[model samples]
Target chain A: MFNEKIVNPNELRHWEGRIELYWIYTSGEAGDRFFKALKDEEKFIAAKCKKCGKVYFPPRMYCEFDFSETEYVEVSGEGSVRAFTVARLDKDEKPLEKPEIYAIIDMDGTDGCMVHLLGEVEPEDVYIGMKVKPVLKERGEREGKITDILYFKPS
Target chain B: MSVGKKDISCPPEAPGTPLKDSDIKEKKVTYVEDHPDMRYAWTAGQAISRFLNELKEGKLIATKCNKCRRILFPPRIFCELCYKPIDDWVYVQDTGTVQTFSISYIDPDARPLKEPIIVAVIAVDGASKNMAFMHVLGEVEPEDVYIGMRVKAVWKPEEEREGSVTDIKYWKPMEK
Candidate 1:
């Protein structure tokens, strides 16, 4: 028999567990460059690994393999959608207004791709191996930022 | 009385010795998931939360180490040095400069924001390599903010303040 209750607990009304959090703050230069590439005609850019001559499409600052200084190279934003998923849930797993087609586009001259939103088509129509190109934003005063290119649609 | 020129007030008088650990209370937040925002809120210790809540009051406070003459922001009451309990308090200035910074086109929910948010790693007036503070930048062109650039707070109105870092509103460039 328990003396009253050793560790008697509620049915657990909410989330209970242990976790670690990493609070990350990023630099402005890297961030501006990232969005700029996305805005300007979807030209994919990769940071060249100064060591092994390998290029990273997602654009890493230091070489993953050798920690060497990397440089940026704008690659052809045109490519086939390598892999993708339909995002039915928000970042917190809550449902979204309208679903989005998230895809990885493998650009020419780069080893990998730039993941972005694919629009202008029904969700069911999106498929693996779809060929697409970046839809650049209109001309005027582009601060060379992202969203300069609107959204990636059938192109 | 002067630490140096440049209008910085005389170095604050150093406090002597640390309080014995017998003074601290044993308390912590209930760490859990399924918040309206975070999948979970990481449970932090009593000292840490006290530091954060103080920020809500629009005050900058850090734990002081009487043993090593060090001040820690995001205040921890235990001295990482000397292996002693920190047990003291020191208020910090809101002024700081960009140590390193980045702008994000996404919000806390990871959704694309209508306008990009300017976030930065501002090294406050008194701290070390790991002591850079995280906050928002405003009133200056995103292009103008750079590494090592100086900035100060554009505090939220006193009446509206709730004692959080957000009460400062954003950091603005200190014109040279």
Candidate 2:
């Protein structure tokens, strides 16, 4: 008994498959508070350390520096761009219809920064240190998620 | 307001407003959902490639290891038991005997289904004893399925066939 090996490359086969699954993400305590504040009040909350008095934007329950309890304080959701980049391609490497500007925004009166999309201004005009404010969705449309703030635009 | 110099003591309880799942669903809290589309491909090596191709043509194929005299279904190029290359490709009967079976009331994700499905390990005829493969069973009640029950392949129509294991739609109990 003898077996013949498949010699032609065209005769070889491969099976196609996919990761047919999804993920559910839950916002923890700090994130829940921060986003709820943004959604309900259109304001931002920072966690101020009871021990060291460091104010953390995107509020946390415990201070990162000294591991002390923190208290929430409200602030206007305004910031300045610390750094920026222009993205001509999306995550899949496909070219976008319009290039998007992304920036690290240093929040006013806090020691933290957030990376978010910048809109309503030309990418070439987006300088570092430019003052910007969050443009939130209509109150009725807000879903308490980060996208509730549509983007940051120069104020 | 600045804290006084003497005002530093570890609070007995941590400061966080615990939220329940109801809070999230009721729009009392915030969350995000993300879905990414990822895909993959697996190469069916020499033996199984031929096996799948034969299935697309509405046939069952197997490989025989002359050294161990064992017939391998869902054919493999090499025999694990004899540690040698299989000697020949052989066509096996589309009929088989059920080795074991289960009635599943839940889907793959563990969600309950309105109707149950019967799945079985079937030892294909013309293959070595115990050379069985897993497949779903149809046209039979869960109570009627038992070990050693004879079954036959139910294939999809020819034009609809893809060179995959699913080319055979399922295995059904054979007529007496």
Who wins the TM-score comparison?
A: 2
Instruction: Kindly list the per-residue Cα lDDT of model 1 for residues B26-135, writing each as its tens digit.
Output: 21111112323334434345455566566667777787777777778767757777787775777878888888888899999999988787999888876544677789
Q: What is the lDDT of residue B93 in candidate 2?
A: 95
Tens-place lDDT digits, model 1, residues A44-104: 6677876677877767666666556678888766777788889999999999999988888
- Local error of candidate 2 at residue A6 (angstroms): 17
User: Which segments of model 2 are wrong by more than 4 Å?
Assistant: A1-12, A16-20, B1-21, B35-39, B45-176
CA-only RMSD, every prediction: 26.6, 9.8
The CA lDDT of each predicted structure is: 0.67, 0.87
TM-score of predicted model 2? 0.54
Which pairs of residues have clashing backbones in candidate 2? Answer: none
Q: What is the lDDT of candidate 2?
A: 0.87
Q: Pick the candidate with the highest lDDT.
A: 2
